[model samples]
Target: MAEQTPDSLTSSITSRSTTRRAVVGVGLGAVALATAACSTSAGQQEEKQSQSEVTPLVDTRVAFYGKRQAGIDTPAQAHAVFIALDLCEGTNTQALIRLMRVLTADAAKLCAGEPSLVDQEPELAAVAANLTVTFGFGEKIFDIAAPAAKPQWLKPLPAFDEIDRLEDAWNDGDLLLQLCANDRMTLAHAQRTLLKGARPFVTVRWVQDGFLRAHGSEKPGETPRNLFGQVDGTVNPRQEDGTIDRYVWGENVEGLTPWVPGGTSLVIRRIHMNLDTWDLSDRPAREDAVGRKLSNGAPLTGEHEHDKADLEAVNELGFEVIAPYAHIRRAAPEKDIERILRRPYNYDLPVAAASGISQHGDTAGGISQSGLIFCSYQVDPLAQFVPIQRRLATLDMLNTWTVPIGSAVFALPPGCAPGQYIGQQLFEG
Candidate 1:
């Protein structure tokens, strides 16, 4: 080659560099396309596998006709709606009987995955999802239909000035219907069907909707955590051990209400949780308030969730491991008869702008309203549920973060056979 000028030499070098970069860019572009194709294929395959593995929760069913209603002792479903209705003017004994008969038949049909006779949306009832419909009678119900069957315990809970900030809108009702299911669609359908069927005989007083962890999210028999991140309903009576029969069902038990054989009482309290203040507290302080570890809900002195809390256990500084004012300690039943079967559900909703008040009456302004629908079932509310509640209301560190805003008590009659209605025993006995 001839001796090249400086400009020629520079041009030759630049051309070679450009050609090399072009080749590299083409190679990189091909590799990127291949990688993207592989990623897309893998993602599609994973999604398809996931879709195939999911089991639809539609076919499962719980029996509707039995000695006791299904929802009280049945496993707590993921969704629930507690509806309170008042008897319409001029609703008499005959009308009450007719209402119960109609409601019972509708409930039986819904629980069996069939629509109610007046169901407007029959397709929604196709999924059973373990639907259960439980009926309860308020004091007025007994006053109108069966005065002699009225249990003394069927009244509003005693005032707890220390913790209760009762609201009239949620206080009491003449009739109560508890609808629970693993699916929200099923629950909503059941609620609508029941309410529509009874609309002619009653007027809606209030409706409280609540929920727990989705079905199958936790293993069977696992205790659920509340909004405050504490395990709730840990110390409930076990059905398999006959505690339910003795404490809840009260079958042939002496000294208990005669009207409660195979029947029970229900107390529903709307407890608002102040999560804004609770979130400010430290983890140790939170656990101390609840008297259990946040990790697994074990008592401070124990390691397992069900471990009996050593109420007398102390630490190095001679302080109680579980504080004297702790929630679990205050809520513990002093007598075995004081125990009640608790089935609670958490509720959360976007705070309404008009009120600006949180569920706990915290007007400091919050983004959400949240609370627990505290439900307890027993043979007698006065004997079993009230005593423990009084203890908690007297002194519970949790009082700083929780407040009861609504309360009601109802007598839950025993279940009836296929041909009988829910409250037939009480009315016709």
Candidate 2:
């Protein structure tokens, strides 16, 4: 049982297929079988195999909530607690590791119900069970002499104008601590758990917390409508066997290290949607704007949401039934769309009193601050990701519903064994 490295994983995915279509057939079956077989062994072999399969494409159970019915909602809950942290002085990787170790331990304690560090802020503690901690390396994350000389692909997006604000937030302990519980009590408990360890390294940036009504009247899921009330992310990547590596990692880029081995880059954006104005657009106009259904996210050509889109479908007048420039159509054009795995959680907040006044109560009344916490994982953020986002940012009709406010790119190093912490590669370098 050899310990897997990023290089080995990248080699495995690249050596298998040349095109995205090839990812689905025999190649995927072979990988799945191989992974299953490797899982049989008792030791390192099993662990390594498991690591190889942990791609972002897998179904990650996600629940979202907002602060309208604080004591009463199910499925999803929400809170915005701004956090800030001071950077460790030197290039002491051990210090950073220690910091994370302590942080994780506190996180566990909070979730498990120790003394309850966040008891004072009951809402924060209630949301701990639904929490996930991730780390990123800034452009300066790697010290000089690190392997491959800080891959050019690792830099932040050119469109991210708020680099300073983002850095400040991260350094200031910026983290989204989510609480996934069915009842208000459970949500409150989770929040208490998270706030315990989070308090030392992070401080509240701002606190606006509450719960969202369950996804539907019957079951929990994404909001029927996006922030704009139009269904979004309907055409997201499906959770299949071998598709993770392709969607998470890039195709044929060379020299770049795979931080998380089989895992890919998770790009998170806080996209603000103009629900007030978006809700005013008529159905036909809205459909024309996005070239898809306002309900199920189906393409304008009547293709099922999950079907391979038919860009060629056109009306009798030769007008493309699905607008040629529609978000989905352009995002995944008939011939050349690169797909990425999306795991988004919805967020809704109450608008500030001042901000809420402008809408004259026409909005969700409470200044409904709802948007998609857009998280996508890809192998090469630079290649597969940036292009699509660039397109969306520049010309997608849905941009009318969304505007990216905060952004950060983190290189997720592979998951480490029990005694190990993340970012072991930085130490080796």
lDDT at residue 415 of model 2 (Cα atoms): 39
Off by over 4 Å in 1: 1-55, 252-255, 354-364
Query: At residue 98, what lDDT does model 1 achieve?
Result: 91
Against the reference, the lDDT scores of all candidates come to 0.82, 0.47
lDDT for residue 340 in candidate 1, whole number 0-100: 88
- Model 2 global lDDT (CA atoms, 0 to 1): 0.47
User: Distance from true position, residue 395, model 1, in Å?
Assistant: 0.6
Worst 10 residues of 2 by lDDT: 64-73
Model 1, position 413: C-alpha lDDT score: 85
What's the TM for model 2? 0.63
What TM-score fits each model? Answer: 0.86, 0.63
The Cα error of candidate 2 at residue 249, in Å, is 4.8
